[model samples]
Every structure is written in C-alpha cells, then in structure tokens.
Target chain A: MILKVENLNKSFGGILASRNLDLQVEEHEVHAIVGPNGGGKTTLMAQLSGLSKPDSGKILFKDRNITPLSTHKRVHIGLASSFQITSIIQSMTMLDNILLAVQSLQGHSYKFWAPVSGDAGMRETALNVLENVGLGRQADTVAGKSSHGEQRQLEIAMALALEPDLLLLDEPTSGMSKEESGEMVRLLKKMKGEKTILLIEHDLDAVFALADTTSVLVDGRILATGTAEQIRSNPKVQQAYLGEETA
Target chain B: MFKFLENLPARVYLAVTALLAVAPLLVTLGSQPFYLDLLTRILILAIAAVSLNLIIGFGGMISLGHAAFIGIGAYCVGIPAHYDIFNGFIHLGLAISCSAAFALITGAISLRTHGLYFIMITLAFAQMLYFTFVSLDEYGADDGLIIYQRSDFNGLLNLENPTTLYYTVLVTLLGLLYLMHRLVHARFGRVIIGCKHNEKRMQALGFDTYRYKLTCYVISGTICGIAGFFLGNFTNFISPEMMDWTHSGELIFMIVIGGTAGIFGPVVGTAFFLLLEEMLSGLTQYWQLIFGLVLILLVVFGKGGVHGLLVWADTRQTAQAQPENDS
Candidate 1:
C-alpha cells in the first residue's frame, strides 16, 4: 500500500465533512471513489492533497505521516492532485502552465534572471506531458482561450508533470461533453497501471470502465470497498447509487 | 530583420529611450537647466515606479505604502549627510539595509492579511513611519531637512556634476528596466505570476509561494530605496512628504496608466504621468482637477493603460483588415 488513512475526521462548524474515514490505496492501481453530491469526496481529496486540514487523523503516504505536511510538501513527496473546478494559471500560455508545475517539482525555482521560456529542459518535459494529454498542439495558446475541456486537460497535464507516485483526480470529467469524457477515460486508462490514481468520479460507467477497485461513499462515510465486480453486486452500493440515479 | 520590424512597439520604445538618453545633451545644447532637472526627476521616479510595478502589476500585491520605501531611502542619504557622514557608499548601504529590513518585517506581517485589509495595513504602517519622521524635530520635523553636501565617493563618478548625474540616473533606470524584464520571465517570475493568478494552484503544484512573495517584496523595496537615494541627490533635499500616502497612490496610478502588462508599461507610464504633471501645473492653479479628470478618463476608457490601448488599437485594425483581405 502506498497510502494509509487512519480514522480521518474533519468537521466544518456544525457539519461533518469526513467522519472516522479509514482507507488504503495500493501502489500501481487505479482506485476510484464514487459518492453522492456533498458526500465529502472532494473534501477527502483536499485533505489527502493537503489543501485542507483534517480535524483529527493520520495520513500516511509511503508509510510516512503526511497529515502535518502542506500541499507542496505532499507534491514534493510524489503525491499530486487535480482540482474539480479546473485550477490553472489561465493568463499564461498552456506550455507555461505545465512548465510551472514541472519547474516546481524540480525545486530550483529561485533561478533569477534566467528566462523560463528559454529553459529547454523544463519546456521539453512540459511538452511531453501536454502531448500525453493530447494538448501538444495547443502548447503556445494562452490557457484561458482554450475550450473548457482543454483547460481540464491542461490541469491534468500539470498534475502529470509532478511525476507523483500517487495521483488524486477530483471530478476529471465534470462538465465535459460525452466525447471529452471518453477521451479523458482513455487517457486515464493509458496511465492506469503505470501510476497509483485515487479517482473521485461521478460517472458510474467511467468507474466501471477504469477502476480496478472501487469505494462507495455516503454522507462522508464509506459504505463499501471492493473489486468493481464485487461493488457492482453489493446491495448497499446499489441502494446508495442506483436508487439515487433513478430518483 | 522582419522580426525587428514586427515588434514595432518594442522598436518604438527603443527609439524613445534613445532620444531620452540624449536628452541631457539636448538640454546642454538648449542651455536649459530647468529641462535637465525635470528630466532627472522623471528618471528617478521611473526607476521607483518600475520597481513598484514588479510587486503590484506582476505579483498581484496592491501595496498602498510603497512611498515609504522611497522616503526611507532618501532619508538614508539625507540623515547621514546631516550628521556629517558624507560617504556615498555608506548612504547606499544604509538605504539598502533599511529598505530590505522594512520590507521583510512589514511584508511578513502585511502578507498575512489580504486584499483591502492588506492594503490598509501597509498604509497604516507607512503612516506610522511618516509620523515618526514628522516627530524628529532635530531633523527639521515637518519643515523637512536640506543636505548641505551631497554624497561623495572616493573621487569616482562625482554625483554633483549635473550632466554626469543625469547620465548615471538614465543608465541606472535603463539597466533596472532590463533587469526587471529578465526577472519577470525567469523561473521565479513564473512562480510569482502563477501565485498572482491562482496562489492555491501554485501551492498545489508544490511551490512555497509565501517565501517567494516576501522575497519579491524585499527586492522591490530595495530597488525603490536605490531610487530614493537618487531622488535625494537629485533634489539635494528630503522631506516626510516624500513618503506620503498620496505619493504611493501616484506610483500605483503611474503603473496602471502604463498598463502594468509588462516592464515597459511602467517606464512609459512614468514619463506620461510626470510630464503631464509638469505641463498641467504650469497651466493653472487647479491643475490637479484637470489632471484627475485626465487620469479618470484614461483609466476608464483605456482598459489596460496607455500601452494596452495601443495594443488594442493595433489588434482592431488588423482584425478589420484581415476580414477585408479574405473577402
């Protein structure tokens, strides 16, 4: 296992966002989490990525306690995540955005007076990541000008640039067209066995299509965790998701 | 060759700066001490404005107490001279140190708060410094202090010579502008801009943004201190009014007018603003009213500043012409 979360609990004022949540992610597998809206799926990812603090919990990445670490430290230690709402430096070029990710990973960000665009090494790596995400041709385009799906792809490209051992993708297909969603599914499939991806997804078809194992969350608590086939047959998950979809 | 022509704006900027470089000689040819003094003041302020643009324009920090750094730098020179310490290097050292320390302490505190709160806290700190200077009765209090002797180096680049000082200020401004250009395009610059756009995203990508912002703040203050040193020498006097909140507002206005889109904007904006001030004040007693009207119109009508307007015009013309050609 590459990640172990022990009794993680977070509360925002009167509401509990994560409640005694215990989970584990094995290395080199695409593990997907499917949950209802407002079920604390994103909140869990936020804590795991160190964007928000858990009220009480121990988050261990590669067996090292990461609960106290910041988002950047988590990134430095081979943990990367994508935002559900598409976080990117929109004013910058698509290539520059990815380059910034790659630049941060390299940790020589204090290189003053040397042009970042002229950095052939960082640029090449960013381009490769862009190409991997099918956005190589849009490298010079300002990210803000790109289509919504393209910006989502750019965000994923940035996540890939961190070269994280475990990747957390939050709603990668949110607001995407059917075709764009298929493309993203294919992209994640391509990287499936090569990286450890903790995916939070809304589309059940996508979860069934890509997730090796699945965890179902309801009201900030895990309802079930098993192989996708097992989770599909599980009566509890059916009541949680199938009932919601029909309603 | 085509690339050079393609960048017409840059080319125009180059031509303008070349003309500015020769301005001192032009003053000599015209035998106009007044023009020389006006231009010298403009260059020093240009340097200060360009530095402020680094923090405000690029870093997304809206500092309202920027003039405090300038005042501190000027005092670094003026205070030393008042006590009969005339070493130019000592003055410069003091200026840089004081400005850096001020930036570090104030930036550490101010950066913790954001937006209007951040702006107000900075203004409040500057006012604190302003009042301290106002209380220094030994240093002439509100009446201000005059330097009997300018800073003297070991007979190197005597700052007293008008032509030499003018050229020196010009060269320094140009150098600082180029340096800023290089800095904003560098790796550190990308992070700063990245933070400006979405600090959380930058942090998510593993950048310690707070440290970067603080360092940038210090560098800006230090450079502004350099300008303050030059301003003190240029005027042969210093005052508490130098760091007034209104002066900081003017610095912000200068960058905004220049478009803050890039390095050249501040330089051009400084020229446009200071020259407008000189021209306006000469025309009427209520020149400020007219100046305010012009600034309001320019800011409202010109989205990104004067440079942005120019770019907008160029794009509009091309966009219009392109359809016609295709049709």
Candidate 2:
C-alpha cells in the first residue's frame, strides 16, 4: 500500500465533515471516490492533501504517518493535489507558474545571487512538465489569458512539476464541456499506469471510465467500496445516488 | 541584439543611472560648486525613492512612513555631529543599524495586520519618532540642529568638497540600485512577489510569508539609511520635521508620479517634484495651492504618472498600427 488513513475525523463546529473514515491506496493504481452533493468527498481529499486538519486521524504515506505536516511539506514529500476550482497564478506566464511549483521541490529557493529563470535545469524541467500536460505550446503565454480548458490542463501541469508519487485531482472536469471531459478522461487514461491517481469527481461516466476501483461516499462515511460493476449494482449506492442509474 | 533589448526596461534604467553619475563631470567640467550641490541633492532623493520602491512597488507593502527612515538616517548623522562625535563611518553605521532595527520592530508588528491597518500602524510609529525628536531639547529640539561640516573620513576621503561628495552620493545610489535589481530577481524576490500576488497561495505553498515581508521592510529601511546620511549633508541641517507625516506622504507621491513599478520612476518623479517645487516657489509666495492643484490634476487625469503616460501613448500608437502583433 502507498497510502493509508485510519479513523480520520474532521468537524466544523457541531457538524461533522469527515467521520471515522478509513481508506488505503495501492501504488500505481487509479483509485477514485464518488459522492453526491455535500457528501464530504472534498473534505476527505483536503485532509489527505494536508489542506485541512483532521480532528483525530492517522494519515500514513509510504507507510510513514504525515498527520503533522503542512501542505507544502506533503508536496515536498511526493504528495501533490489540484483544486476543484482552477487555482493558478494568473498574472504570471504559464511557464513561470510551473517553474514556481518546481522551485518549491528543489533546494533552497531563498538563494540570493542565482537567477532562477536563467538556470537551464529549472527551465528544462518546467518545460517538460508543461509538455506532459499538453500546455507546452502556451508556455510563454500569460496563464490568465488561456482558455478555461487550457487552464485546467495547466493546473495538472503544475501538479506534475512536483513529480509526485500520487496525484489528487478534485473535480478536474467540473465545468468542462462533454468533449473537454472526454479529453481529460483520455489524458488520465494515458497517465493511468505511470502514476498513482486518486480522483474525486462528480461526473459518473468519467469516474467509471477512469477509476479502476471506486469507493462511494455519502454523508461523511464510506457507503461501499469495490469495482465499478460492484458499485453500480450496490443497493445503498442506488439509494444514495437517488436511483439515477449510471455507468 | 533583440534578445538583449528584450529586457529593455531594466537596461534603459541602467543607462540612465550611468549618465546621472557622469552628469556633473560633463555639465560642470569646470567643477563648479552650485551645480555639484544640485546633483548631490538629486542623488540623495533617488536613494530614498528607490528604497520606497522596494517596499511599495515590489513587495506591495505601502509604507507611508518612508521619510522616517530618511529622518532616522539624517538624525544619526546630525545628532552625533552635534555632540562632536563626528566620525563619518560611525555615523553611517549607526544610521543603518538604528533604521533597520526600528523597521524590523515596526514591520513585525505592522505586517501582522493587512491593508489600511498596516498603513496606519507604520504612520503612527513614524509620528511617535517625530514626537520623540521634538521633545529632545538638548539636541535643539523643535528648532532642529545644524551639522557645522560634512562627515570627515579619517584622512582618506574628504566629504567636504562638493564635487567629491556629489560623486560619492551618486555612486552609492547606483550601487544600491544595482543591489535592489539583483534582489528583485533573486529567489527571495520571487517569494516576495509571489506573496504579494497571492498571499494565501504562498502560505499554502508553506512560505513563512511574514518573515519575508519583514526582511524586505528592514532591507528597504537600511538602504534609506544611506539616503539619510546624504540628506543631512545636503541641507547641512536636520529637524524633527524630517519625520513628519507630510514628508512621508511626499515620498509616496514621488513613487506614484514616476510610476510605482517602473525602475526609473523614482528618478523621474523626484526630479520633476523638486524642480517643480523650485520653479513654483519662485513664481509665487502661495505656490503650494498651485502645486496642490497640479497634483490633483495629475492624479485625476494621469493614471500612470509621466513615464506611464509616455509608455501608454507609445503602446497605443503601435497597437493601433500593428494590431495583430500586439496582445
């Protein structure tokens, strides 16, 4: 197993966002969590990525617990995540944004005399990451000027800059068109075997198509866990999904 | 050739700075005293404005108390000179240390607050310093003190000669500007700008953003310390008014009039401001009203100050002619 979560709990005031959740992810496998509205999928992903603190839980990465670490520390330690909303530095060039993400992973970004953009290695690595996410052509363009779909791709490119062991993508295709969603699915399919992906998505078709193992979450608890077919036929999932049949 | 000029903005600034250094030699090859004094004053203001740029333009930390650093630096020289402790190097060192220490303390407290609160806290601290200076009767108090002579350099460099002092101030300004340029493009600069652009994202990226901001604040103050040393020499006098709130406002106005983020903005703004003051005062006794009106007009109609206006006009012309090539 590459990641393990035991008895994870998060609450806001009196309402529980995540409750006694348990999960384990294997290396190099595409695992996904599917949930209905306000099902706490995002809360769990936030905790796993160190964006939110769990009230009481043990989060183990590579068999070492990392409940005490910050988001950037977790990123430095080979865990990276993208937001459900497209988050990027809009005023900077697409390449600069990737370069910043890569810089975070490298040694001592506080170096005074060395010019960051002038470094061949940093530039080459940034370009490579941009290319991997198919935004290489737009590297010189300001990120704010890019199309929405392109920005989403740039988000993935930024996540790739860390060379993370696991990529956590939340609603990667939230507002995307059907064709764009298909493109994202294809991109994930191409990356499936090479990286361990944990996708939190709302689009059932994309989730079923990309996820090898699907876990259904409803009301801050695990409703079921199995292959897509097993989840599709499960009675609780049927009720939670509002009897709206899906692939 | 094109690649070199791709960084044209920074290059032009360097060229301008180089010319400013040699201006006295070229214009007053006779080595006249009056022209030398004019050049020295310009260079001093340039140093102060440059420091202001580091915090306001780059770090996005608006400090309305910038002149307080100048006052701190000036008083460091003036107070020591008043007591007959007239070592130039010691005075400069004291100025740098005192200004930086004050900046660190004020910055640590103020940086925890954002926007208007930060501005008010910094202004309030400067006022406190101003009041303290006013109450110190032994050093001339409200009347201010005079430095009978410029700093003596232990028999190596004489600061009394107008031309030599002018050149020294110019060179120091140029060196400090170079340091600032290098700092802005460094890893520390990137983090500073990154924080300014998006504080939350930088925090999420695990940057101790407050430390970086406070560090910048101190660096800016230290640079202005050099400016203050020049200032006391320039006027041959110092007063509590050096730390006054209006002087602080003028420092910001210089940056605004020149264009905040532009490298050469401070030089242009300072020159324009000082020259206008000289010309306007000569024209009438109540020239402040005219100056105030002109400032209002400039702010209302000219969003980018003079340099920004020039750039905007140039880009607009080119954009109209070559729409496809422009963004």
Candidate 3:
C-alpha cells in the first residue's frame, strides 16, 4: 500500500470527527470515499493532507509514519492536494501560478536575475500542464478572470506541478455544471496510473464512472471497502449511505 | 509601438533618476536660499514616504506608527550629535540599527495579530515609544532637541553647505528607491506579496508567512530610519514631537497620494504635496485646511492615489486594444 491509516481518531471538544478510521490505498489505485453531509469526509482528507493532525493515529506513507509531519513536509514527501474551495493567486496569470508551484518542486531553481518570461524550459513545461487541463488558450489570462470550471482545472494543474507520487483531490467537481462535472470525470480517468489518487467527493455519477475501489463512510467510521461492483451491490451501503437507487 | 513602450529599457528609468539627482545643480533659474532649504526638506520627506511604501504598497502591511520609527532614527542622530559624538557615519549606523531593532521586537508581537488588531497594536507600541521619548529630559523632554551644526564627517561631505546637503540626500534617496525596486522584483518580494494576498494559501504552499512579514517590517523600519537621519540634518534639529502620531499620519498620506504600486509614486506624491503646501501657504496662512480638503478629494476619487490612477488608465488602454487583436 502506498498510504496506510491505522486506527485514526480525531475529536473536537465534545464532537467526534473520526472514530477508529482505518484506510489503505495501494500504488496506482483510484480510491474513492463517499459519505453523507456530516460524515467527516473533509476531516479525514485534512488529516491525510496534514492540514489538521489526527488526535491519535498513525498515518504511514511508503512505510514511513508521517503523523507528526507538517503540511509542507507532507508535500515535500511526494504528496500533494487541491483545496475544496479554490486557492489561487488572483493577480497572477494561470501559467505563472502553475509555474511557481513547478518551481517549488524543481530543486531550488529560482533565479532572481533572469526573467521567467524568457525561460523556455519552464514556460514550455507550464504550457504542457495547462494544455493537459484544456487551459492552453487561457494560459496568459489571470487566474481570477477564468470561469469557475477553468479555475478548478487550474487548481488541479497546480497539484500536478508538484509531480507528486500521490494526488489528493477534495471535491474537484463541487459547484460545477453538469458538463463541467463530466469533463472533470474524464480528466481524472485520464490521470489514472500516472499517480495514485485518493478522492473525497459527493457526485455519485462521477465517482461511479472513475473509481476502481469505493469506501463507504458514515459518522466517522468506515462501513465497507470493496471493488466498485461489490460497493454498488451492497445492501447495507445502499440503505445506510448511498441511496438504493444509486446502488 | 505600445509593446515597445511596455518593454522600455531600464536605462530610461535610470536616466530620469540621474536627471532628478542633478536637477538643483544644473538649473539655477531661482537660487533663493529658502527655495533650496524647502526643496531639501521635501527630499527628506520623500525618502520617508518611499520607505513606508515598501510596507504599505508592496507588502500590504498597514503601519500607522511609521513616524515613530522616523523619530527613533532622528534621535539616534540628534542625541549623539548633541553630545558631541559627531561621527556622521556612526550616527547614521546607530539610527538604522535602533529602528531595525525596534521593528524586530514590535513586529514579533504585532504580527501575531491580523488586520485591524495588527494596526492597533503597532500604533499602541509607537505611542509607547513616543511617550518614552517625551519623558527623556536630557533630550529636551517634550520641547525637542537642537543641533548646533550638522555632523562633521571626516574629510568626506560637509552638510552645512546647502548644495552639498541636497546632493547627499539625493544620493541616499536614489539608492533607497533603486534598492526598493530590486527588492520588489526578487523571489523574496514575490513571496511577500503572495503572503499579503493569501497568507493561508502561502502556508499551505509551505512558506512560513510570519517570518516574511516580520522581515518586511524590519526592512521598512530600517528605511524609515534612514529618512529620519536626513530629516534631522535637513532641519538641524530633533524633538520628541518628531515621533508624534500626526507625523505618522502624514507619512501614510504621502504613500496614499503617490499611489503605492510603483516605487516613484511616493516621490511624486511628496513633491506634489510639499509644492501644494508652498503654493497654498503663499496664498494664505490657513493652507492646512485646503491641504486637508484636497487630500479628502484625492482619497475619494483617486482610489489608487496618483499612481493608481495611472495604472487604471493603462489597464483601460489595454482593455480597449483587445478588440483590435480579436479582429
């Protein structure tokens, strides 16, 4: 397994966000977690991303325990994530935003004397990543000016810039139109095997279309974990979490 | 043609600066001693304004107690010069070191809070410094201090001569502006602005935003301290009133009038403000009332100050040209 969570538990004052939550994601696997509104999906994702620490648990990545690491350290260790609410530098161009992220990952190659505009290698790599998300035409446009769907794609491209071994996306399709959601699903499908992906999402259609394995989470506990077919047919998962029609 | 102007050589900027540096010497249309003195004062204030812009414009830090840093710097020079410790370089060095130390200490505490709270704490600390300076009877308590003469430099520059003094301030201001330009474009500058916009995002991206903010505060204080040194030399006097809260307001006002986006905005604004004071004072003794009204107008209409107005014009011009490209 590329990521292993052993008995993670987190509580806030009197509220339990997660209780004995255990999950494992193998290399190159697309793991999907579906849960109800108050089902602690974001809390689990935050813990994994190192944004918030688990009250008690061991999170192991590549056989190394990272329970005590910081968010940036987690990023340096080949783990990257996209925010649920868009986090972008509004004044800078989309390309510049992605280029900064790429620069961070590329072994301290920041040269203050040379203008980034004329650097062909950096520009070309940024262009390729922009093209991957169909934002090639909007590369020079400020990140703030782009449509919401395009902004979401820019967020993913930012994550891709890190060239992480695993990518964690929290609600990549939230607040997107039906067509935009479909495009996001298609994009994620293309991203499979290029890197390990752990997704927290609610849009069942996209999840069913993209996930190889599905886990049901309810009230901070994992209900079941199985192949997509098994998850689709599980009665307890249908009645308790994923409505009968969706199952 | 537009693209050529947009990518104009840095030499053009350097040339303008060079001309400004030598303007007083080259032009002797009116060689009034008072005019020279007034111009020197404007130059000193311009330096202070520019340093404040480093924090206010580029770093997005709203410092209301900036004048206190200027006060610390002036006293650093005045107290030593008063006591006959007349080494010019050492006085300047002491001034800068004192201001930087103050910034480091206050910034550590003030930066822990955000937004309005940050502004308030900084203002409060500056007031504390102001009162402390006022209580020092040796420096003249609330009355202020007078320098019998400018510092005696060892075989270098004599500040007693008006022309020599003007050039001295001119060189220092130009050096600071150049440094500020280079700083804002560097990697550290980008991170500073990035943190200003979205600190949480910068942290998520693995940058320690607090350190960047504290460093900016120190740099701003140090630069303001330089201005304070010039201020003392220009007036040949220093006082507890130098660190007054109203003086801080004026420093902020200079940045606002100049527009905070570009380096030279503060210089332009300072020149314009002092000129207005000169022209208006000639008209009436009650010139401050008119100055206040004009400031209000500038704030209301010129949202980005004078420089911001220029940027708005440029942005509109670019937006207008977009249709031509589309065609």
lDDT of 1 by residue, B217-275 (tens): 99999999999999998899999999999999999999999989878888888889999
**Which ranking of candidates, highest DockQ first?**
1, 2, 3
Q: Tens digit of lDDT per residue, candidate 3, span B1-327? A: 355356223334455567667667655555556777777888888898998888888878888889988888888888997788888888898988999999999999999998899889889989999999889899888988988768768859998888898989888888888787777665567667777777766656655667778888998999889888888877888887888888888888888888887888888788778888889989998988998999899989888777777677767877888899999
- For residues A16-102, what per-residue lDDT tens digits would candidate 1 score against the true structure? 989999899999989999988888898999999998999998999999999999998889999999999999988989999999988
True contacts kept of each: 0.93, 0.43, 0.26
DockQ, each predicted model = 0.88, 0.42, 0.38
TM-score of the first chain of model 3: 0.95
Q: What lDDT is reached at residue B189 by model 2?
A: 81
Residue lDDT tens for model 2, B86-159: 89988898999999999999899999999898899999999999999999999889989989977877967778
Error of 2 at B136 (Å): 3.8
Evaluated against the true structure, the overall lDDT of model 2 is 0.84
**Candidate 3 at A45: error in angstroms?**
2.6
Location of the lowest summed lDDT over 10 successive residues in candidate 2 chain A: A238-247
Give per-model CA RMSD.
1.6, 3.5, 3.2
What are the TM-scores, per candidate, against the unseen true structure? 0.97, 0.88, 0.90
